[model samples]
Target: MKKAALYLLLITLFSKILGFTREIVLSHMYGASNISDAYIVSTTVPTFIFSFLGVAIATSYIPIYSTIENEKGIQSANIFTNTLVHFVILICTLLIIVAFVFTTPIVKLFASGFDKKTLSLAVLFTKISIFSIYFIGLIYVFNSYLQIKGKFVIPACIGFLFNFVIITSIILSDFFNILMLPIGYVLSYILQFLFLLPFLRKHKYKYKYSFIIDKDTSYYMKRIFYLSLPGIFGASVNEINSIVDRTIASRISVGGISALNYAINLNSFIQGLFVLTITTVMYPIISKMVVESDVDGVKKSLNKAINSITLLVIPITIGSMIFSEPLINFLFGRGAFDSKALSMTSEALFFYSIGMIGFSLRELLSRVFYAFQDTKTPMINAAIAIFMNIVLSIILSRYLEIGGLALATSISAIFCTLLLFINLRNKIGSFEIRNIIISFVKVLCASLLMGMISRFFYYALLNNINDNLCLVLSVCIGAITYLVIIYFMRIKEINIIVNVIKKKLFSSFNVL
Candidate 1:
């Protein structure tokens, strides 16, 4: 488990860095203009339409697959898998057809503030990119299957190919026709599906030509379908909020959507690199524990996962708040990313950072509910958050504009995470909430101190040194300072990590 988590972290980190490069390329070529906005909406439309299904499939499939394998055996499970693949492909095809026919209205729903030219481009892009749902659905199923099979490497590496394809396409689009952008976006997913096929076969996963919907398969399909409905709505909370943000942003300014997208990507980087790596590794294990009726084990894993997220996310959040502008400027200040774009993106990043820990916790907690096969709690809680976000966004955007949209997102996440905690205790009894709070307090203190020093260093060196160099050094210094404070504070999670590193070093020395 440790090795799998670490491997995933490394892969995610590397892929995310490449993914950031992809964003940088996009920003350089297009900035936060109508062209970029149109392209972003085109890509976002499919995700907005289908991501709930994707999340629902992944969250619901894991435990269901485990149950079938345990009771009916691997052959039965494989048949169920075949049935699911066929069913998902059929559903995706239908969705694609519908989306294609209503592409303009769908584009309008996501980006209503678009002018005729921008709206037309978005519609065109959506027409081509909508087919990605087919690949996206299959990828989700295969990814869960591989994770269940304990083959994490290939699933983790797909992002590499996906990002590479995207970056290449963006560059080509710049040099040649802009149509290459959406064309490349669709091609990336196709390549990712192809990339996973051989690995699936290697893991003894065969694709049966026959789609069996026998009694057993039918029962499991019904189970997955029921579970997925709530999961879809539960997962859709975030996507729905995103659609709201983009729609509202479109009304705010020309580059509003692009600014939000860039900032959100930066915020997502932290969640993706740490929170996701932890959850992806722990989700399968926790699902098995649930199958074994290991409630205590589930509780223990949830505590550790939450603590890990807090320890990882809090300091980064503080740093992001302090250095939002510098980070955005450092990364995207060049080329077409002008001063106005910089200010909008930085403002968005700062506000988004406020809810970074909340978002991370909500993600982990939601996964726990899903592992226990209780999606309804999260769905209800998400609905509550969605209401809060919408209300706050309307009120705040009136004042804060882009920042208001972002702050509303953070506030909603924090509130939703709090509700999940209360309901989670009611659902599973106390899962060491006291310890989590204690640890969080310590992490927050350490992070605050680190942020102050980092901010000091940043400002002190601003006049004497290059902006990028100063920002990089200040971040490095902040990281070191954070490590020192946590070490002295003897944070339990940090110590565990320290000891693990020590062991690896000692083992390597012995090998030498």
Candidate 2:
């Protein structure tokens, strides 16, 4: 498990580096402008649709795939996959066509605050961007299969290829900037989908034209649909939240949608680095364990994941809050992104980062629940959170604008995480709740000290040093302070981290 997590972590880290580069380029080129706003809003239709239906399929398909392969055999599993793939493609393609024809109304629904001109531009972009969902939908199917086979590396690193192509597309957009942007997204999605074909071929997973569904396929398909019903609702919670935020943001100003996107993207980049990496690596194992009725194994896996995420995310969350401005300035304060844009983006980042721990735990916890095939619990939890978020967002946005939207998201996340944890505990009995709380207390102490130290250093070097250098130094100071304090304090979570590092290092040495 540690080894698989390490592979996923390293590859995800690499992809995130390139993804970071991609965001920087996009921010510099477009800033929080109308064009950027329209572009983001344009993609919302496809994003919302794919995130729900597409992600639902991917999230629920893997465990069933494992079950079928175990019970029915690989040939049966392949046929199941082939038929499933064709069905998803056919459905998504039809959806895309409908979305294309009705682009204007969809974009308007997505961003009702857009003016005539911006709405027109968004409609155009939507026409182009919606097609990418076809590839994205296909990618989800392939991703489930790969992860089931314990093929984490390539699936993990494919985002690197996606980012590389996106970077190239952004560079080429100079000649026809606005129109080229969405086209680039489509091209990258295409390439990403194509890149996975070789893996399928290598595994001899043929397409087999699966129109006639056998009994086994029908059984699994029916189960997949049953599982996917709640999965869809659970997954759509965030999409629903984003839609609410974007709609409210659109009322703020022309660039409201763009500012929100930039902030959320930055937050996602950080979360992807560690939180997501752990959860992604754990999902398959957790699912398989649940299938095998390994209750203790599942508990151990969840605890380890929670500890790792909490330990790593504490420093990042606190550090980001302290140095939000410098971080934003360093990453995106140039080109079309001005001082005002940086300030708003940084403010949003601060609010969003405040809930990092909650978000991290929620990521892991939700998967654990999914492993138990109890998606309804999470769906209910998300429905409650979304209600809270909507009420909070409407009331708060009047004052905080983008920051309010983000703050509402944080509050809802923390609420969702708490409820999920309590429910999981009640459902599974107990296993070191007291210890987990103690570790969090220790982490909080360390993070507080790190935040103070980083803030002090940031202000001290404000005008004296290069902006980038100063930002880097401040972050280093915070991270080092947090790690040193945790180490000296002898926190329990620190040891897990130490062991992971030790194992990773020894493995590297053996390979060399």
Candidate 3:
């Protein structure tokens, strides 16, 4: 488990760095302009479709696949995989048809206030992106298989291909003056799917066409669908909140969607770094424990996962919130994105950062229920949270513009996290509630101190040199200060992390 976690973390870290570079390139090439907004809007529909289907498959696939592995061994798992692949292919085909038919309506729904040109561009982009939906869906199944087989590195490395494709496309677009954005997106998914082919071949995962679903396969599918129903609602809630933000932001100003997208990209970067790494590594472990009825193990793993994620996420969130302006200016204050764009994006980033811890917690906690094969409860909580988000976005957009959309998301996440925890406690019988609370308080206090130090140094550096160099230096100083404070606080979780790092280093050296 430690090895898997470390491998996934390393790959996620590398991928996230590349992903961040992709964002920087996009910002440099397009800035927060109508073109960028159009591209964002166009990508949004495909992403939404992908997430809905991807979430369904990912949430259902692992547990069922794991169950098959336990019951009938590798052969059964392969059979299940073949069935699922065929099913997914059919579903994806239908989805593509739907996307093609409703592209204009969907584009208008998401980007309602866009000008004719931007709307047309967005519709075109959406249509292009729809081509990748099936490919991405197939990739999800392959990834789930790899993950269950404990080959974390390959699955995590897939994102690097995505970033490379996007960055290359963005660069080419500069010279070609073409809408290479969707082409980049389609290529990335294709490559993402292609990357797994060798592994699938090595594993001997054949794609046999069999409409015959065995009893066991049927049973598992029923279970998965039943478990996944609530997740559909839950996932829909989350996606709808995002769509609402875009809709509201579309109404606000020309660059509103782009500004929110920039901020969200940064948020996702941080999340990919900390939250995603841990959750991805933890979920299968949690699933196995639940399958084995190892309640104690499940509790232990959950506690460790939560603590591990929170300790890292809290500080990063605080730092981002503190130095959002400098970070935004440094990465995106050039080319078409000017000081005004930076200011707006930074504000959205700051507000989004406030929900970072909640978002991270939500990922960890939601997976706990998933491990227990209970997706409905989280779905219900997600529904309430989504409702809150829509209401808050509508009310706040009138007053706060794009920033309010971000704030609404943060507020909704907070509500969702709280509800998930409460429900999880009831389901699990008990949790490390007191310990989590105490650890969170300690981390929060330390983060507040770090935030103050970061703010002081950031402003002081601004006075000295207000260029990108100073911005970079400010981030370095802030990060160092935050880590130093966290270390001195003797956070117990830090010790666990250090021990793991030492073990991995020594183990690698021995291998060498």
Per-prediction TM-score: 0.98, 0.95, 0.95
Ten residues in a row with the worst lDDT in model 1? Answer: 203-212
CA lDDT scores, all candidates in order: 0.91, 0.83, 0.82
Segments of candidate 3 deviating more than 4 angstroms: 204-216, 500-512
Give candidate 1's whole-model lDDT. 0.91
Higher-ranked by TM-score: 1 or 2: 1
| lDDT tens per residue, model 1, 1-512 | 77899889999999999999999999999999999999999999887777888899899899998888888888888888888888889989999999999999999999889999999988998899998999999999999999988878789899999999999999999889999999999999999999988777763665443655656688889999899998888988889888889999999999999999999999988899999999999999999999999999999989988888898999999999999998999999999999999999999999999999889999998988998899999999999999999999999999999999999999999999999999999989999999999999999999999999999998999999999999999999999999999899988888888899999999999999
Which scores better on TM-score, 1 or 3?
A: 1
Show pairs that collide, candidate 2: none
Candidate 2 weakest ten by summed lDDT: 203-212
lDDT-based ranking, best first? 1, 2, 3
> Mind giving the per-residue lDDT tens digits that candidate 2 earns over 40-118?
8866778787887787788788778777777878888888898788779888988898998898988888888988888
Candidate ranking (TM-score, best to worst): 1, 2, 3
Candidate 3 local lDDT, 123-230, one digit each (tens):
988889889888888888888888787778888999999999999998998999547888998999999998888887773544343667666577777776788778
Top candidate when judged by lDDT against the true structure: 1
